[model samples]
Target: MQKSITNQNQENIKGIIFMVSAVLILPFSDSIAKWLSSSYTTIQIAWLRFLIQAIILIILSFSLKYKITGFHKKFILVSIYISSSIVFLFWGLKYLPLANNIALFFIEPLVLTLLSVLILKEKLQKNHIIAVIIGLIGTLIIIRPNWSAYGMASIFPIVSAIFYALYLITLRQVSTKTNSKSLQFYIGVISTILLSVIIVVCELLNIDSFGFKQIDFNDWWLILLLGVITTIVQLLVSKAFFYSKASSLASFQYLEIISASILGWLIFKHIPDMLTIIGAIIVISSGLYLISHERKNSKT
Candidate 1:
């Protein structure tokens, strides 16, 4: 019993480390994407991100002898859902401050909680309902709908959150049956293909799609860093889940908001207003409470 408890503690520690590292690195990729969005279209950026990730995944699969199995229709849907979320996030990043974007995107957890209740028929715990309401109120505070300052771009993150929630729900369904490497590779391939088609259609239509921009040597490095960091962070997050329960690791994700805020201030001279800061605090508190509530329920 003592040995089992020690092992679990070790796993939790490792999971915390992995999750913290991933969250810290994630903001850098978002900052890069926001910077690149200035020069490239969202579709173009999404395509490159997935293309690079797919290439690396393919190489890793071969070297590691990871089998590429599972070619279900749900794989395609997951790819599209995730791809759409990325595109919307990049689009919003163009106009929104990084902190604001992160805060709004934080609604994803709440959305996921709601979906679990609705789709999975999980018990609608009272604490969860309260958490969801608090989270939405925090989101509204950041968005400040009365002011209408962010305009249509404000809607992008909300849309992204919805798609992201759907992605998580779908991921839950497919994850049990598929190997993680195989699942990621399939999603990457499908996303790359879908984005490539969008790019081609934009080119053919001669539309004002944020069509591909010329990549200078300097810009090439930034784009490469974006893809590599994203892939690494994702792997770390997966490893974290492997090491510990998802509920135990949930609170660490808010680190991204802090990291994003600091990065935004340093890189773009963007600071969250008083209201935005307050909203972020509220959102984080609600999320933490929800995680604690879930943990307690699991224990019982």
Candidate 2:
């Protein structure tokens, strides 16, 4: 019994480390996207991000001999949802401050809880309902100030969060059936294909944002860095979920705001206002409350 407890504790620690690392590193990619969005359309940046991801994963698969074979039909849907999540996030970054964008996106865990209740047939406790309400209120607090400057663009991260929550649901279903590396590889492949098609269609329709414009080496390097960051973040998150009960790591996600705020200030000279900071605190608190309650309920 002691040995088992020790092993579980070790796993929990590992999960926390991985999850925190993943969330912290994730903001760097968003910062890069914000940097590049000045010169590229959101769609183009999204495509190149995944294109490079697919390429790296392909090379890694071949070199490591990782026979990645999780090509289930659901992965295609996962691709679509995750693709939308990222594209929407990129769109948000173009208009909103990085810290604010990431803070608003933190609503995802609440969204995920609600989704679990609806789709997974989990019973919705009163606390879950309360959390969602508080989460939405927090979202509004942040949006209220940004509305004048960013208007509808401020909500893009929420849209991104919703699709991302959906992606998480589908991902939860398939995650245990295959290796994380394989799942990530297929997601890259499918997202690359799906985004490519969308970009082509948008280009044909003469959509300005999806046009294939020329980019210099600077853009190329940022895209490369974005791809690497995406890959690393996903792997770290996967390891986190694998090693730890997600509930234990829920609070660590808030660390992202720190990194994002730092990046925003340093790279873009943007900072979240007091209202946005309060809103983020509320949302993060509610999410932590909801997840912790859920974990307690599960234990009981």
Candidate 3:
């Protein structure tokens, strides 16, 4: 009994540490992406970020001696999720404000929770319903859409959120049936292919000449660092989820809002208004409560 308790405590500590590390790193990653988005088209930046991560993922997978599996059903689902998410995210960032964009992206957890009921056949608990409400209200508060600055920009992030939710739901299902390394590999492969297609089409249409235009030496270094950060943050996120209960980790997700809010003020000089601050607190409290309650029920 003592040994079991000790092991459990150890796991909990490790999980909390991993989860916090992941949560903190994500905002920094977003800040970096936001910086890069200034110089490159969002799509080009997204593509390059993943392209570099893909190469690193491949190298690490081989070095770690994870098995390279042949393609399967889950691989296809993974591919679809990755491609859709990358496309939608790139397009969304082109329109939305960074904080608003991320707030909309937070809609993913609610969507994922609902989808799990339909697809994974998970129960639609009361907590889940409440979470959806809180998330929706939070989204509405953040948007407060205006025609001049917000018109279509408001729509893009919501669409991105939906696609992201789909991606998360599908990824969860696929993860259960396959190794994480394999799932990661296939996602990278699919995204690289998808982005390559977008790059080719951009060439054919001569959309902006920006996508294929030459980047300076400094930008090149930033892009390289962008790739490295992308890969590392992903690993940290995976570790967090792997070590902790999903519900526990899910609650910590709201930490990104707090982080983004802080970073936006300090780094970008963009501060959340009173409404945003209130909405963030509401969202965070509701999400944390729901997650903790769910965890308690699971234990019982």
Q: What lDDT would each prediction earn against the true structure? A: 0.77, 0.78, 0.65
Model 2, runs deviating above 4 Å: 1-13, 121-146, 243-251, 272-300
Error of 1 at 74 (Å): 0.9
Model 1 lDDT on a 0 to 1 scale? 0.77
Give the per-residue lDDT digits (tens) of candidate 2, residues 1-300: 767766776666676678768887999999999999989989888888888878888899899988877478888888899899999999999988888788778777677766765675656557656766776677668656545777898789989989987886677667777788888888888888888888789889999777777889766777899999998888787777676543344445656776787788899987678987887788677657755664554443
Candidate 3: worst-modelled 10 consecutive residues by lDDT: 242-251
Which ranges in model 1 have alpha carbons more than 4 Å from their true place? 1-24, 236-255, 291-300
State residue 9's C-alpha deviation in candidate 1, in Å: 12
Clashing pairs in 3: none
lDDT of 1 by residue, 1-300 (tens): 767766676766676688778988988999999999888898888889888888888999899887778688898998999899999999999989897887778777677767766775656656656766776677668656632778888789879978977876677667666666777778788999998888878787887665566677778898888889877876776666566544444445655776788899999999778997887787678657755654554344
The lDDT of model 3 is: 0.65
What's each prediction's TM-score? Answer: 0.83, 0.83, 0.82
Rank by lDDT, descending? Answer: 2, 1, 3
Ranking by TM-score: 1, 2, 3
Q: After superposition, how far is residue 51 of candidate 2 from its true place, in Å?
A: 1.2
State residue 246's C-alpha deviation in candidate 3, in Å.
Answer: 7.9
Clashes of 3: 0
lDDT of 3 at 111: 65
